[model samples]
Target: MAGLLQRVKSKMAIFAHRKARGMLDGEYGSVFKGRSLDFDDLRGYVPGDEVRDIDWKATARHGSPLIRRYAAVRRQTVLLVTDTGRNMAAEARSGEAKKDIAVLALGVLGYLAHRHGDLVGLVCGDSTATRSLPAKGGEAHLERLLGHVDSHTSLDAAASRIQEQLEYTARTIKGRHLLFVVADEIAADDAMAQLLRRLRAQHEILWLTVRDADLAPYPLTGQVPSAEVDYCSVADSALLPWQPAASAAVKAAYTRATAERDAARRAMLRAAGITEGEVAGSGDVITGLFALLERHRRAG
Candidate 1:
């Protein structure tokens, strides 16, 4: 089988081709703050490049925009935080497994960290337990990290409880690091919100929410077709297709509840001072991450 890290690189390559060359790399690099003033080199400017980084004299001479690259004062650690449990094995909005989307997102960030000469670590677990891997460099180490996430998550695994991993990091991990989290739709809770706020105080954080599959078919005008609701819930045996008599009123309630949940989740993250981006599937990972990184840079 093709390696997971290889697949991530392939996706990044495609994104680079679709966008400007080195655009994603530039976006990833700029997300961090407080770099050394020591000049390293200059590269052609992309659309997302910071305006302040442009050297006007060099740009005028070269007849194109150029961005100054600085030697970073210190290497940063990017902690890939995620949930590895039955919840992740459930279907995502795009009908792909949520675990697959999580893995893809994690791999992309880890690859960007590796490219930037930053160490990458992982903190993931289900409700039963949490696991941590020390930050390290090199493609081999990244592969091992990705493989661990892939191998552990399954439909039979323990229920997902991202709070466990978050709490583990808070209690054990030391020093400042960039915490990149990817998880599915999570219900709002006061304790989780408070925990997130505390973590934000200690580290730079970015969150990516993998959209969950819809509970019911949209525009339910009654007499919904079986094909419309073919999927079954992973956490339960509830099957929408079996309930052909479900009225439009049912759909309305689901919509309202979903909207309220989303709003609350957003409010919680915003209150914690974290930047969030969402993806529905593997296809959206790169674009979502680009937006996430850009938002983090702007917020910082």
Candidate 2:
């Protein structure tokens, strides 16, 4: 028993160190406080059920003892929509990839939401969309979300699935929910808007641009250097096998084009009343997320 207790202690210490549990008991209003006890349902009053467990509503009707049951308070519903496209799977760290970053962020969010009595769900998209179980309160739900997230593969199959998922999301969910998207840079500035309108009609939306810095900045590496950078790949992928000078020019031109795309992306986000999240080189993913939630709460 002592050894078991020590193991438990060690596990808790490790979990606490991860900042997930730290934030749980942290000074913030994150720990979901209990709500006023209310009716849940009624069953037979057990020995420990306070006399108050008696449900007058059923008791009076049935002329028998019906213990009142009160379930835990309902928490917020926070949904994470992860892009499982090839873009999102790019490796940033030698060992950890962009998909790893996304999943880690989702884990953190799920843990925090669990503490706040919030229901957490995850939707991963490629060309198709894959979703975990619907949001419900509990650590089990978090585990389930992670399990589903881990099961996802970023191959081309997701393409068709994502479209179908988007179509399905519009039909099933009917009320406001907090929806977050973790995706690579978008091609269309208005892409997010269309997604929001179709897939997340009733939810408040936020988009987290998960990227590897290399995608934006091509570094001079190796004696031969990176394959001739073709600026037109994003615009037109047909131009290839250019001369070294052409590659240099392509790289320069891409620098400018990417900047323009970013500007357009942000402008579109603002127009749609959505918040943007950034996570870059050796970057701390939680920095912007904390601020996003705080600001959102204040707005609410």
Identify the candidate with maximal lDDT: 1
Model 2, position 249, has a per-residue lDDT of 71
Candidate 2 Cα errors over 4 Å, as ranges: 1-73, 92-95, 155-167, 189-192, 197-201, 212-247, 281-283, 298-300
TM-score per prediction, in order, is 0.83, 0.63
Q: Which stretches of candidate 1 lie above 4 Å from their native place? A: 33-72, 217-230, 237-246
- Per-residue CA lDDT of candidate 1, range 1-300, in tens? 989999998888887777732776788886664564346899999999778788889999999999998776778888999999889998888879999999999999999889888899999999999999999999999999999999999988888899999999999989778899988899889999999999998888999999987664445334455564365656664564645325556667877998999999999999999999999999998888888888887775
Per-candidate Cα lDDT values, in order, are 0.86, 0.56
lDDT of 2 by residue, 45-143 (tens): 667765644777888898878986655655557777776655555555332566666766676666665666667777665664455467787766666
Winner by TM-score:
1
Can you give the lDDT of residue 69 in candidate 1? 85
